[model samples]
Target: MGTNTRRALTVAAWIVVVAIGVMLSIQRFRDAVGSDIGTDLRTFVAAAEHIRNGRSPYTEFGYVYSPLVAWLLLPFPDFDAAVGPWTAASIAALWGAVAAVTATFWRALSWWQRPVLAGVGIVTALYSALLSLDLWLGQTDTFLPLVAALAVFFASRNRQIASGVSLAFGAIIKSWPVGLGLWMFRRGVQQRGRLIAATVGTGAAFLLLALVIHGPQMFSEWIDRTLVLSEQDLVAYSVWGAGRHLFTQSAALEPLFVAPIVGTIVSWTLAAFIVALIVITLRRPGDDALSMWNIATAVVLLIPVCHLWYFVLALPLLWTWVAHALKGTRRLESLIAVAVMAVWWVIVFRLPPLDNQFGESTPQYIAVVGSSLVALTLSVVLSARRDADRAVVVREAVPA
Candidate 1:
């Protein structure tokens, strides 16, 4: 494609993405108001109200979030009035994240690649099923993923403290971004020491503040609620969760008679294994960018709940990879990777063919499990190879 033609096509694609986003937003808004059912934003507002009224959110409505989240919401004028505005605000903030990440990619590209690649990358990311689900559900996980993205962007620019603080804030709100922090630790001994100190110090301060505001009992209650929630029936869209649904639904697997809770156990086991793998990869030096992308992917894949919104954590990483592919010889491989991912995400998260209960159909199950496994394996291999290549370059640079 000619440069001008590609740029024009990318622009047209972005227009389509925007139109789709607007349509989804209108439908979601109608659903939110008409159904009288509360989304996560409403839950968050209710929890904030409890905190404002000097009650425990955990005791009131089983709010699983850390106390810091409730405290953060205290400044909102009225809890009931805050939901729509906060949802809108989150959407706006998510756009900012898209811009930040796009700019990050632009910075890494040649001038000729910037306009076309930026438009294509941002449009591809924003149009994903994961992001569409995120906006429609009023999921506050948007902010955390945005923070994690900003952390990577800052770290890439050598802003250690800023990066640490951003990742630490996300970790304080939600635990997934801790993986990003660990990836940054892979930079080197000196940088890791600085990053760890800043992250730990910031996180410790936040916890102490929460402890002072809400007593030790509140901490105990929060911990209990989180643990209880984790052990709930696995409705999660994660690898093992989807596999469990598939297995339970499969008539062929019926003879095996797998226990329902077995899936939950397996998901947690996989989560631990993924965590170990990422940590080990980070501990060894590699391309910092590659490490960040791999760590983000690993964290999202291993998260027990793995809600659709949570997958937004992978947006920056995915788009960056896409840009690299568009500019590289392996464009076909990247296209296949992305197309498979979009299909898996749509089936597993956006449009599950089966009901909440099990069913006869197993296509969604097979698609989700197969695509997830393939993507995860591909990510690990690519990251390891990039790291090895970087190591070879460093070795060759030194005097022989």
Candidate 2:
């Protein structure tokens, strides 16, 4: 087939995939809307309602999210009366933001590559199991991907101010997107004055909104609420969490404070990984912005406390990477990408949560070990490959 014909077919296929995925997501969301699920969404809504009633969302309610996220939730009603519509609306808005950012990034790609990139994005977004879990729990993980996508898109376009604002907004909502700010700084994008302006502007906007919604006292309460939540035992339920949990659960474990030890180890590991990635990207200035972002997002996703919804943050970058990688016929990496998507779907949909019941089984151990190994292995392999590629490019660019 001619290249154009192949591209057309690819585009048609992606459209179908995206349509089907949307239908499935809607069906799952409908089934889950009225069910009592996910604590984060409920907490956010409650806090919002408190503020709307002329009470401090921070002082009157126990909410852990940033004031801006709570403020955004304040407009929506609680789950009691309009659960279905409210849940659906939130999902729709989150997905719409994802779609918009994806489209903006797509426009930056070459015509022939856009379709392939869209296909990868659809695959990542639809990864039925992940979306199912997010919908079933009414989780806000979807926002992570949307926010990360916006940050990346703006940063790639040299809109540093907008990127900083997006990063700040995401951080306020979930606290993970602050990693993006670090990533930006490592990339030397932090030197742009607009980035500082954007960060300050976004912070001021959040403070202003908080004051308007809940009076000045909300600031102190917000800090207190966050501190209380942080001290709680919401330790790792993620892959990294699994290891920490196991170590803590062991009878022979030391009294060195398992959570903090694990946390510190993970923090240092992530810092080293980021430094290496930044150095590699710096050496290969010819590499695309999306590629660098993909590596950064992947590293962040592999962090111990990262939840399933965190995968959403990696989708945009993944789409960009897969599109370019596949264009050059990198079949093995493409297959790995497919496998990663499958793993996410399985975890999001099939893996049943162990509710601290006493019955231990070999199958449970197998499931946990197998999943962690897969995630960890993929993370290592991908990071190594990117580093190696950068090294090769640097070597070839030098005089013989």
Candidate 3:
């Protein structure tokens, strides 16, 4: 194909992709406008109203985010009127995240394989039950994964300061991402110092601004209301939540423990194991797609109550897996593995998460939390092997 034709085709492909996204999410748009859902947006708007009236946003029942978020949305006083546009903006942010990944691997694939990956992206979006649920509820967190993109692309590109500030900005929005600072601190002394100073300085500024609005007590109130203990949620969506189900005397599975307390202790141990795997398996000189996914997914899973929208943070890892199939050395086998994994994932999550009944729906919940972790790890391991093989060839080629 000629250059002009290829350019036109690329533009057309993206347009179709965008149109499909809007069509799939239109019902969600209506649901938000009709007040069928969007409690989160309403909460933010309500919080902003409180601030406008010289009150704390924590006064609103569901306003659990940082005071800075409420301060940011103060322009929209009437939430019912704001829901439609806000949902549209949420959809746009998700598209931007996908675009970022596509751009990352654009130069590697052949022209035909490029469109195949676009199809892969479509499948990814469709299979993401949590992402669909996120849209349906008008969640604002669709924008969080963009920070993961920045972290992946900017970390080793002589842009450590920019990466650190972007991550700090994410924490200012949601707070869970503070856990990602672990990898940030693993760089060499100069880079680590820039990252730490940038993150701390940015976060301190966010808290100081909120202090002026709601006083220091506001953060404490936000933490109390926002952070629930894992044991408290009867049916959670975390790894610990799956562990809890194994000990219950349910029809699907026999109780593994005689008492609920035994189950609680066992589940906490399981969660701790998951955390260690994520932290320990991540290699240093860390700024790759797999490392970024490891840290981000670990942060999300560690949450006491992992919600559907929160998994939006992990989409980058899924995208990376698909990208690796096209970009990794064992293209044929890696492609098949990820293709099967992606389809199996979709089947597991096909039904409404809270209402499903395949092995008490425990498998579904656990797999959703664990699948990306497994996928990314396998990809990273295989990628390392491929690199080692190439190094051997290069060494043998040198004078000896």
Candidates 1 and 2 compared by TM-score, better number: 1
Where model 2 places Cα greater than 4 Å from the true spot, the runs are 1-11, 34-38, 93-113, 188-191, 238-243, 250-308, 315-317, 329-350, 353-400
In model 1, the runs with Cα more than 4 Å from the true position are 1-36, 75-80, 128-133, 176-179, 187-190, 239-280, 283-286, 327-361
Q: What does candidate 2's lDDT look like per residue over 1-400, in tens digits?
A: 7998978887786677578657756776666764567555676677778767767666445576666666666556875544565567656655655465556556555665665555545545654555655665656666666665666667767788877787677667765565555545443354467876787688688778767766777677767776665433333334454444444553322223456567557545645654565455444332334443544454554455455455555555445545545555345775675567456446533555333223133345335434544544454355446556766777999999
Query: What is the lDDT for 182 in model 2?
Result: 50
The digit string of per-residue lDDT tens for model 3 on 44-64 reads 888889889988888887766
For each candidate in the order shown, give its overall lDDT on alpha carbons.
Answer: 0.62, 0.56, 0.64
**Better candidate by lDDT, 1 or 3:** 3
Number of the top lDDT candidate: 3
Best by TM-score: 3
- Poorest 10 consecutive residues of model 2 by lDDT? 353-362
Q: Which sequence of candidate numbers ranks them by lDDT, best first?
A: 3, 1, 2
- What overall lDDT, based on C-alpha atoms, would model 1 receive against the true structure? 0.62
